[model samples]
Target chain A: MAMKIGEGKFKENVNKNMEDTFMRGAVAGAQERLRTRRLDAAEELGNWEEWRSHGEEIRKHVLDNLDYYLHELAENLQKRGGHVFFAETADEATGYIREVVNANGGKKILKAKSMVTEEISLNQVLEQEGCKVIETDLGEYILQLDEHDPPSHIVAPALHKNKEQIRDVFSDKLDYKMTSKPEELALHARETLRQEFLTADIGITGCNFAIAESGSVGLVTNEGNAGLVSDLPKTQIAVMGMERIVPTFEEFEVLVGLLTRSAVGQKLTSYITALTGPREEGDADGPEEFHLVIVDNGRSKILGTEFQSVLQCIRCAACINVCPVYRHIGGHSYNSIYPGPIGAVLTPLLGGYDDFKDLPYASTLCAACTDACPVKIPLHELLHKHRQVIVEREGRAPISEKLAMKAFGLGAASNPMYAAGSKMAAAMMKPFTKNDRISSGPGPLKAWTEIREFPAPNKERFRDWFKQHEKGGGEQ
Target chain B: MKVTLFITCIVDMFQADVGKATVEVLERLGCDIKFPMGQVCCGQPAYNSGYVEESKDAMKKMITTFENAEIIVTPSGSCATMFKEYQRIFHNDPVWRPRAERLAVKTYELTEFIVHVLGVENIGAKLNGVATYHPSCHMTRLLGVKDAPMTLLQNVEGLRFEPLPNAHNCCGFGGTFSVKMGNISEQMVDEKVDSAEQTGADFLIGADGGCLMNIGGRIERRGKPIRVMHIAEVLNSR
Candidate 1:
């Protein structure tokens, strides 16, 4: 419910998540299922790489010409009698959304799954205004009922919770007895939310891709809640990050293909709903009054910068699913709603480094996120970029680390320094050596020694061995 | 073929056997091995930690060290990818960029060199045991050397290779990331070790030393009997 759910100290969060054996089992199972489904779907697509590349290209093209398309999108939406509001900050976006709700005299609001809304803390704002906001997405709804537990994943928000946890939450909150089977739980939620969907005054959803050509907004979901929310409500509001747009429907189709494949590993999700403007005559579904909220928040600053590639994210969370770090600690450890690789880069940018500085360093520079990314965001590089910014611009890097890296650069770049360092390493580690491995180490090595034995630096450096052999100083 | 061996710092010091095995394996495949005396650590340690200016010195040193070698091969996939990254690091230095590009053109991860460059899939090595391979993130994702190791491993006589669960996830050995963010790193490597053990592998194999060190160390701490071996060592096994 809060932006900083698992945002405590990273270690504490991991320890907590690790202790929850039930949650870990749930996460591991979900990951295995999703990973398999994704691969099968991609294989079915025949040219999955080409599709990924096309998706990346379209996203790049859009980010490159974002301003031009944004203006066009805004103007077109305004022409269709839809109100287009661009909020430059999170508070501004929340204030605008709240003002709209208050003006409409709306109290009960049903919401579709929208990460951007979460990023801006929109629900709390609406709550503060004495309005009830209900989440229609089953995962988010379960999280909401459990005393506003933070979403552990972007796509599968409640991935860390098992069916039993859900059953407990439902029983405690709704006072309904149900088995922990997924079918029974789904049936319970469906029965409960069906009425809220019908009676809701306003529907809020996140935009998957905003088509600039026709001034249309798109939402992709496995569950049909996003579509129902947009259709059944009298007043509809769609919140989107500015960069989540495509130049045309052709580009939209390309990205949508990539999103489904990369995120869920499917050719397409069950629903790919597109809504342009308010309902026209003869339209059986869709809201009568449409509001388009294009959120800049911190996106405009990322444009034309080294970190610009980050804006190309489609929020499919494929990168998160594949990340090894995310696999163990889960999403909440990121402390931001956008956990994982994409979250590591984007969250600190939006929320600032003070709260999210450590997020960037959470990666091992493994490049798994980059490879899995459908938009080719170069996520690992962006993480490195964050480290650079933290060190150079923010001046937040520790003095010891700075000094150590300075020494590393010097030693590694010069043969003499490297030789000297290598020569001394054996002696430097002399205190820890026993049977060629250090069971316990000092300083930085302590972390490593905590989990595994550290190999004591070898007494005979390879260069020394090689030098004697090259000069024929030793027999072959 | 003359192959220059970029013995990654870890292999040069902590795990010299991996480097030695790499050399013998390539030599057995009928390639001449050259150890450039001027070679040092790849700039990865500094670069990944955000010390660009510091890392560039080593980058420049590496460009010069293996500039003229006919083909550069390294025991570690991540370090080989570091050679490939030299061009990107030197994109602004016209002098180094072309030289870096030339180096990248010839650099290959050991198994990748054996399979893709040398055209040898089966090394005729025999290791009678069940094993699981951890696909190091840098090797598989960054260097894009996905199937070469598996291709070679499958052909090893008398060897049963189990696919590691969550094989693609990192073992949390991001150089200093292991030390800098120790807690999270431990958790990550723990999960990786668990996945490998889940495969019921007698030995856990990997192409990169950093990941091996992390996972192997944890397995030792936990007193897991699983043996950890480098892919080069496995390939060179006779």
Candidate 2:
């Protein structure tokens, strides 16, 4: 019900996910497809690097003047006859949303895919108040029907579910007999969701970027569910992270371009909805009352810090698409609503290191995330920063690791110690060495040797050989 | 050109043959090579694991060791990138920052030095075998030395180069990550080995010692019969 999805430890979650060949296969296939498409889209856009810089500049500018933009956005939204609430914590955000639902006597709410709401656990809170909450995005809908399965991926919530798995979930929950074809599954979900859209008393959506100049919330979707969720219900609520704001339409255009391309390799998604405030003066069907909930929930604390660059992220999942670790471990292994590289960096900041310390260490500092990032968050570097904090400030690293690292520092920094260590390494490892490889190594080598052979230490170190050869003992 | 070698600790101890090949290749190319005895580990294992202060001690040692070199070259891309990282590590210290920057500017990965500085691609080395190259992640992405190794490999006479599938993926050798998260690392290296096997290449060539050790160890354990060689060794082969 919370942002943190599973109860298992990070290792247990990874081991569990590693054993799920079905989920692993699905994730691998999706990663390959998305990675290729993202590359193609970047190439097609031409000057992707320039675009990335432009997007980074815009994001950095907005964050630099975030207070001004947030104030302007709220004032404009209020002028357009919308209620605006600033929730500092998850409980506050969900409580305010609950009050609105209770005041309106809302029984059933139709919701588009909104990660901020997921972060606040709004659905669980509303459902506890005896409201029927339905997820309208096809991915979310399938996940919802399967008994509140937390989204494995940020972009594609049900990415862990294959078509056959979806068919199974539908058959068990919805009593629908359908083949394992995407078209059929989508059509069934559409037919089912269409009824919920027509009958739901309220609609809730997540804002991609709130345009400050016009007080308009932008939503990008390929399925057009967000448009329906905002338009069909009489009372509409748009929830967004406090950091998700832009100064004007010009900045909004730039960010949206980066988001669509980096997230899904699209020039523009099928639907781009900008809802200013309720119906305005129009006669068309739209919400009469609109509310904007700006949820801080630990984001504002990240500002003016080493992690300020993390807020510049557009939730593209571009980093995740190329992450080699994510390819093996999958999204569920991250154990959060948000998963992969962004989640690894964010979950710790939002949830604290007690639950997410291992997340930072989950990476190899490959910098693939940094390279793929549209706004250039320097994600791998941020991951390293988390490690530094854990060791120096948090003092949460294992005592053994700390001692080992301290010894390493002494040995490596001093030439004599390094020379002695390298010299002794071969003789010390000789007992386990056979056929130029250590089959069963000692201490740290145990972990290495468990999965693969560790190369036996060279008895004659490279420097030794170099010294001998340079003296004309063998060559020349 | 006078070149100072930063033979990474991994190559110096575990893969001495890689270091030898590197030295022979560079010497044959008409360069006076020197090894700074004061140089030791790059401190990446500790630095990446979050001991920044402790790792800086080793980094400072490296900066001091190679302080007088006209050019510093390393057989491993990961270690060379670590030299570049020293500037950021000492960013707050004016004295160390400038010294680290100077060291960084002159440091080059082996293939990068060969193709860019020496202006030589084909070294006239010949080896007859089907091989796939694993572009180490740090070298390709962070150091931006994507084409240098390929350029040199392409010119290696009698060597049949097969493009490694999913070549952009890291081989699960994140130094300590290979041991710390061994379970997940196993799955990753397994995928890399499977992909290399799919290419039907008899040899797996890599630029970084860490990656070669990871993949090479796996090949030996699985008894896959695919030999692993460093790019330097492949280039020096005759």
Candidate 3:
């Protein structure tokens, strides 16, 4: 429910984000860096396409047998003394967590950049119940300090913010005096969060991939905050989307390998901690109680549907990084924690077509996202499918567009109708034509010519000229 | 070699020069070119805009239009991609699926047809200009024709080909999207023009009409002094 962020129509958000030069500049720069790094990392791996295929195979296999893996994961975790809670809805997931918090008198909670927790609005729920939740990841910590500005991207949440903005946020919120240098800002945040990491009663995190064989949850992060989150607190909660499970550590290794390289171009992040159950017998360091909450807010329904491939996503934002639309509009335009190409496809499925219908059409169907997907999600196809549903099944398309398309279908299917239309185009457009182009005109030309000049309809159609050339003995 | 031309709706109505050039280039390559008068739109605009069922009629019409050709060629990579996509579009229809498949295999973008089918690397065309090429999204990524245009472009005797910076990015001409999301498309196309400008190429050469129209239109509107040429026209240049 909380997956949808900000308060506006998609267009309104896009218009606002387009106007944010600071954010646009930051997004464009990050996209280039991340894109280059990802490509370099993929190339260094040698046979990246093969690796992508292997990754896709593992994800597809796991998704196909998700129920079996989920059951195995839960039973194995239970055997290892880990409490497993399967929540069917966002409300149920948060309600169970709130109960867990109240039972343990868990007032201070430190979270380690969990997107599922954000999806469930866990922080606001716990905050209302008097729990002071602190975000430990640097980007997340910055956003938390900035009075909970919703995350624009999944992996790099604060990618929309520049260092100057971070410094401003830190100064305004934390009463810190510091320059906009990244090192200084990071050190300030680390100093601020170290106390919370030690003192918080509960630690929360999102699972990168859960292993069904050993019932271990893998958390990948460069910040080492996830390690601290899973190890420091007495009560540890790992919330995962139901589809984030693999058959074993072997599959886990394959996916996590793709995740890191595709995500931030790291061979192995500073932290790739895999935790199974609570603290075991004679364990040197671990949580006293570990809870794995498997959430299926909308995933189970999509399992057998045409959209099942979407659940194979590892949440690496490589698709976001290469998306030209995402580059222009930035992440916030999506109005979801999951922004960019993946977000455009996944958000509508998780959220419905009502508010999210526009998300599918937001894409140019460029297929960059599909090519960049480590698991080969066919993101552009999925986006097109959403449009099909909107126009064909949902009947949500506008009356004008529907009528226009109806006419298009008639004209396009019949050659005589088309020939007539093309023959009539020049004469009909003559009033609007000047200097061989329609710079500005009426109807559809109005939207197009606003930004670019459209060529006036050719007075002599190509087929007509071809016939003339044919009769003139192939002469130019 | 015989080639039936699916001169797409845009080329037939708007950029007739591209169509004319395609015919000339193919004819020079010893191809007996046939322009099917029955061919119309590729159903991409309606199909991409999400009218799958409504677009099928146009698709079927196209399939039948080019059913008897030895090979199908088009100036636009995007429309060729749409032609290739027809097989999948009619996947569930027993009657049309095979018919669509027959059309899909024989279809080729003009440059692809010139370089691959005709087995000719260059047309020996000469044009005096520094130029850059925009690999339109559907042409490069969807149809998977990455090398043919560049192969042909690299051979043009008098042209200096500078690689477009961030050239792989979409020029934001997603049919109705150009109008539907004009604000965002404006930013995207502007960046594309900026990249093409950065190439210091007087001529911005491209393979797809949709993309060229979008980028070329923007260039012309902004009076950026960059001339946009379709690869067919570029190949036909002397």
Tens digit of lDDT per residue, candidate 1, span B97-187?
Answer: 9999999999988888888888998899999999999888888877888899999999999899788877777888899899888877887
Calculate candidate 2's fnat. Answer: 0.90
- Over the stretch A389-455, how does candidate 2's per-residue lDDT look in tens digits? 9999999999999999999999999999999999999899889999888988667899999999998
Per-residue lDDT value at A473 in model 1: 78
What residue runs in model 3 are displaced by over 4 Å at the alpha carbon? A473-475
TM-score of 3: 0.99
> What's the lDDT for candidate 2?
0.92
Chain B TM-scores of the candidates: 0.98, 0.99, 0.98
Docking class of 1: medium
Candidate scoring better on TM-score of 1 and 3: 3
- B27-127, model 2: which lDDT tens digit per residue? 99998999978889999999999999989899999999999999999998899999999999999999999999999999999999999999998999898
Model 2 collision count: 0
Badly placed stretches (over 4 Å) of model 2 are none
TM-score, per-candidate, Cα-based: 0.95, 0.99, 0.99
Per-residue lDDT, model 3, residue B44, is 96
Clashing pairs in 1: A7-A335, A38-A265, A452-B217
